[model samples]
Target: MSSTDAPRRATIADVAREAGVATSTASVVFSGKAKVAAATRDRVLSAAAELGYAGPDPRAASLRRGRSGIVAVVLEGHLRTAFLDPVTTAMMDGLTDGLADLSSGILLMRDEAGDDAAALANAPVDAVVLIGCSGRARASLEIVRARGLPVVVIEGEAGEGIPRITLDNAAASATIARHVRDLGHRDVALVTLPLDSDRERAPVTDARLAAATVDVTVERLTGTREVFPDAPAVSASGSFIDEGVRVGRLLLADPAARPTAVLAQSDLLAVGVIRAAEELGLRVPDDLSVAGFDGIAVDGISDVTLTTSVQPAVEKGRAAGEQVARMLRGERGVTQHFTCRFRAGTTTAPPANR
Candidate 1:
């Protein structure tokens, strides 16, 4: 409440008066920095509850800091759709840990906005982290740069002297593809993330391949092709289990024509392919071999350990945060590279006919 009125929201001052203590004392009770007598603490809390005073306004501290104390994380798609990916969630967790020293809050935003970089322009944040380099992400990077704020990108092009957290997507994908190839999976199919910002689900063709803007998708695909040059590729709209299931059905509908193995870009997609195989009464690694990336444990596929490449997801986020912290301190931000480790599980085997 700004002034005396008929009814007003309670403030910490009001709670202090009700508790018969000084405003600073009531504030310290909420801060929990210093210890107070049990009786005094309870009295202050009870008074706060009675007056509907939760705590001091946190914005006041940010105001004193002279910065928003917020870090904006731009995702490639809708916030709801983006959060569903465990990879993104893990990266965010790492990012939070990295920013822990700063006590900064995260501001999740969409990379693709209806207007041209309007969201990035209007975001009240001290720094920005772009997850992927869609066309929109590139634009957002420019916007943040023009505003003279620090920027860090994960798994995308952070060229032009910007710091980036990179994954060896191509090298890792090649390793996994070689694992499949060495297992005699001559006839194989590939499931990929979106080729472009449109997130269109379709059979990857020369036109789609040429128009690809997502470096991660392209890098992973490139690596696989080094092993399976003629492997048929299907691009999902996004990295999701259901999207995998959808394309899995299309790829496996004709048993006679289906590839002996499916190399999905993500574990969730691989799990979806496994589900599609089960629905068709096909035995995994017996009738159809399925492999995935990202090394995440999908709840439904616990019985079968996923054959994938485990990337350091948390470390990626933490590294990004650390770079952001460096830039915030007026220091040069360094680009960091991460690699993936291949893990073989019960999911892969030599082709049945091999």
Candidate 2:
């Protein structure tokens, strides 16, 4: 029991010997880089447990494999804000599930191109996933490309030669707009997500639309415009309830100028619009019709169910993760397109005046 008599620590080779398999087989069992038979995997695990082999240390494995074994998830703006959106949260959950078997870790980085460029440039990650990135964040892509890292973007455009997990933003928004128009809502207004990385909370103007750099914002706006060509629209600073409230107040303040209906780009904003309507003694649908995108649960905000187009947020994340996995395995770039389902809820109805 003396220090000199201490036993040597077990390694993958020892585990492989105990399992009657090659070291490569044992390594793949732990690394998850390749597929092995279930029975063989079970035997390997049993041997590791018997020998007190706690699998491979990630650091040592990364050194041996020349990979970081980490994936960086780049989000636009503050990390806190990204987590607040239910859609983003759902997507992250799915991404986690999709990347689970890769034996990879997730590192969240805020893509403030100018300020964090150096940090992102130096981050130790085998792959990068851009989630709902804006124009400012898109500028950081050059740095990522310079590093020769594999890239996947969810709900954002990344130009050619890059894999993108995209939604039919324009088509979905158009569906919502058409529904509102079909309800005989002639006087309608549009509330939008931030049109640029500046996150300006102001009325939508020709200058801002012309200067828009966010693809999702632009696509959704284009969809709405297709149905309500002359409708007045306001852009929210962010995709939050308070931002929606600010937009709602600005649009519904004056009864003489109030629209009969409002189409909000997000469910949270729709809830805010309803709040503004109630504050002004206007009943939803009966006095003011409201519609929202993103089929997230809006219960407890009001009794009214939100009429919206529900995109597969989790599936989008999974698709991005799958693409990243493929790239890590030396596959070429791939792209995936997802569609949304439109559900009519209690929030949208024929305007009383109509």
Candidate 3:
């Protein structure tokens, strides 16, 4: 056919005509909302493929249903860091699996909250899930709520009207401390997650402790204090191994002021502490004991397993996904809480004097 006389661009009406079905049937087939016979659905898909049609137009579908079929996952830091954390990875996996049945896709939105709150206010999402956010993130979250979208906060608490998916951060940390106390380690130090975006790395002082804005940091620190009221805590800029190593070296450098045990907020941090201990010629458990949270497997570290609290990362994600699904189905979604179990490993043991 001549260029001007070429066949018309395919539309849902054309697909419906080719499939010998009504436009509504064709829409249902593509949307997968209404139950259609398997054969009919297959016929609609085949017809659309033959016509080079890319199924329903998202713009048109969104207008018709008043929904975007997209859920935004608001992350607090760089995308690379979000993917590195086992906790975030596990939760994302579970959320993906849980939403698989719904055929909804996830849109990862980074909430840096610079100059303006444009991203949070303008995201084309029907709902949002806050992943590991704190401090200034709370302000962005308020914007998300103001936009009238349902929100689910994971690993952080949301005030009334927003649903929360929480882990027992305080109780779990306290449990880990109690384990250390039971091992007869009186002198202990802590390596904490970032208390704020300032990413400060220094000895956790009373002022720093009071000014902490991160919920996880606060909870874990509170838990540690339950046992070691005067435990010397140091804040790490992040949960990365390098940060852990830096904090570890600083803590172990001064033998005169070093503690017998170290409790890191993450497995990666714990591994760093172990490396630091070895660099200082301190033997594991024999001279120092270290413990961490999250049971993620670490590589290249031999003969030493981290003593940590094993939280259900994937399960937490799945639960969040299920909650999102419930909200979409016109159900009153409820908050969920999970706990971590302590895993005694080679990195921790009785104090050297024993």
Give the TM-score ranking, best first.
3, 2, 1
Could you tell me the C-alpha RMSD of candidate 1 in Å?
A: 4.1
Best prediction by lDDT? 1
TM-score of each: 0.85, 0.87, 0.89
Task: Give the clash total for candidate 1.
Answer: 0
lDDT per residue (tens digit) for residues 1-354 in model 3: 788897877999999999999999998998888899999999999999999998767666665788888888888778878787777888899999878766787998776776446877887788888886587778878898889887788877688867788889899999999999998999999999988878799888888878877898889889889999988888998888888889999999998988999999999899888888888899988999999998898875796778999998898888888888888788877988889998999989998877
Better of 1 and 2 by TM-score: 2
The digit string of per-residue lDDT tens for model 2 on 19-117 reads 999999999999899999999999999999999999777778776789888999989889978888999999988898878878899999888855588
Assess each prediction's global lDDT (C-alpha) against the native.
0.90, 0.88, 0.86
Cα lDDT over the full model 3: 0.86
Better of 1 and 2 by lDDT: 1
Off by over 4 Å in 3: 1-9, 19-46, 53-59
Candidate 2 local distance difference test against the native = 0.88
Clash count per candidate: 0, 0, 0
State the TM-score for model 2.
Answer: 0.87
- Candidate structures ordered by lDDT, highest first: 1, 2, 3
CA deviation > 4 Å runs, candidate 2: 1-52
